[model samples]
Target: MELFVDLQIASENQADLPSLTLIEQWVCIAIDAGSSKTRKEAELTVRIVDSEESQQLNGDFRAKYKPTNVLSFPFQNPPGITLPLLGDLVICKQVVEKEAMEQNKSLNAHWAHMLIHGTLHLLGYDHIIEEDAVEMESLETKLVLQLGFPAPYNEQE
Candidate 1:
C-alpha cells in the first residue's frame, strides 16, 4: 500500500512536533493495521495548528469549547465515485505537548498515539459506544505497542 501525506504546519510552536517522515510512518502503521484489503494508493493531509484554531474548530464541529488534541475529518465520497482520498487530520501541537507532560508520556509516543487514533477514525473506527471503543482501543494499543510505545489508554500514575 502506498500512502501520500500533505503535511501542513500552521502552528508557530514546533517544540515537540514530529517530522513529516515520522508522521507518515505512524499514519501508515494505523492504515496497515486497520485496513482489511490492500490498496494501490492512499492520500490524506495532516495539519498542525495552534490552540486558537483548534478551539474554534472544536467548538464549531464538536460543540466543545476547549481545544482538542486532534480532530479527524473523514472524506465522504460521492455516489458512483471512488477516490484515494482518505481525509484530513488537524492536530493541536500545544494540546498534545500539554497532554504528554500531564500524562507523563513521551512526546513521540503521544504523537504516535494521536496520529494512530485519528487515522483509525478516518477508517470509520469510533468510540461513541462501549463495544466500539473497546475494539478501537484494542487496535490502537496493539499498533502503539508495535511501535514500542506504551499503551495509550493505560494512564500512568
Candidate 2:
C-alpha cells in the first residue's frame, strides 16, 4: 500500500499527529476489510483541513452546510491497472480536536478512528442502512481496537 498524506492545515499543532507509519498501518487494515480481495498496490490521499474548508466541501458535495469530522471521496476507474487510486479523505482538524475533548478520548486515538472511518468509506462502506451500519461499525470497532482505540460506538454516552 502506498499512502500519500498532504497536511493542508498550516497549524504547527498538526505536526504532533501519529507518524506516517501508523497511518499506513491503519489504511492497510481498512483496505483489507473493504476490498473483496487484498489489493496489491493502493494509492490514497489524506488531507487535514480546517473547519472552514470542511464546511465548504460538505456544503458543496453533501449539501449539509456544516463541517463534518471526515469526508471520503472515492474514485472508480478502469480495472487491471497496476496502481489503484482509492480516494481522498478530508478531515476537519477543529472538529476532530473538539470531538476528542468532548468525548474524553485522546487526540491521537480519535484521529485514528476518524481516519479508519474515512478509509472504510473510500472502500465503499456505508452506514445508511441498519444492517450496513452494523457491518461497518463492526469492522471499525475491530480495526480501531487493533489501533489501540476504544470502539467508537461504545464510546458514545
Candidate 3:
C-alpha cells in the first residue's frame, strides 16, 4: 500500500517527533489491518490541527464541546470498487501534547499512537463497545509495537 502523510504542526511548542516516514509506516500497518488485501492503493490525508479547530469540529460533528486528541472523518463513498479514498485524520497538536505529558509518555510515542488510532478509525474501526474496543486496541497495540513504540494501553493498567 502506498501511504501519503501530510503533517501540519500548528502549535509553536518545541517537541521533536518522528519523521513523516515513521508516521507513514504506522499508518500503513493500521490500514493493512483494517482493510482486505484486495482493497489496496488507497489515499488518505492526516492533518495536525490546533485545539481550537479540533474543538470546533468535535462540537459540530460529535456534538462535544471539548477538543479531542484525534478525530477521523471517513469518506462514505460507494462500496465495491477499486482505488478507495479512505478519508481524513485530524489530530489536535495541543491536546496530544498535553495528553502525552499527562500520561507520562514521550511525545513521539504518543503522536504515533494517536496517528495510528485515527487512521484505524478512518478504516472503519471504533472502540465504542467493549468488544470492539478490545479488538481495536489489540490491533493498535500490535501496529504500535511494529512502529517501535510501547503498547498504548499499557500505561492505563
Highest lDDT model number: 1
Over 1-157, each residue of candidate 2 has an lDDT whose tens digit, in order, gives: 5555544453335755666777777778888777887776788888788788889999999999999999999888767654578888888888889998998888888888898899999888999998999999899989888877777776453
Model 3: lDDT of residue 87: 86
User: Candidate 1 at residue 47, lDDT?
Assistant: 98
lDDT tens digits, residues 1-157, model 1? 7899999999997766799999999999999988877778889999999999999999999999999999999999999999989899999999999999998899999999999999999989999999999999999999999999988886442
Worst 10 residues of 3 by lDDT: 9-18
Q: What does candidate 1 score in Cα RMSD to the true structure? A: 1.4
Clashes of 3: 0
Candidate topping TM-score: 1
Name the candidate, 1 or 2, with the larger lDDT value.
Answer: 1
Pairs with steric clashes in candidate 3: none
Q: Please list the C-alpha lDDT of all candidates, in the order they appear.
A: 0.93, 0.81, 0.81
TM-score of each: 0.96, 0.88, 0.87
Residue 108 in model 1: shift from native, Å? 0.3
Task: List, residue by residue over 1-157, the lDDT tens digit for candidate 3.
Answer: 6666666666555466567787787788778887755454777777777788899999999999999999998888767755567888888888888888888888888988998899889888899999999999998888888878777886464
Number of clashing residue pairs in every model?
Answer: 0, 0, 0
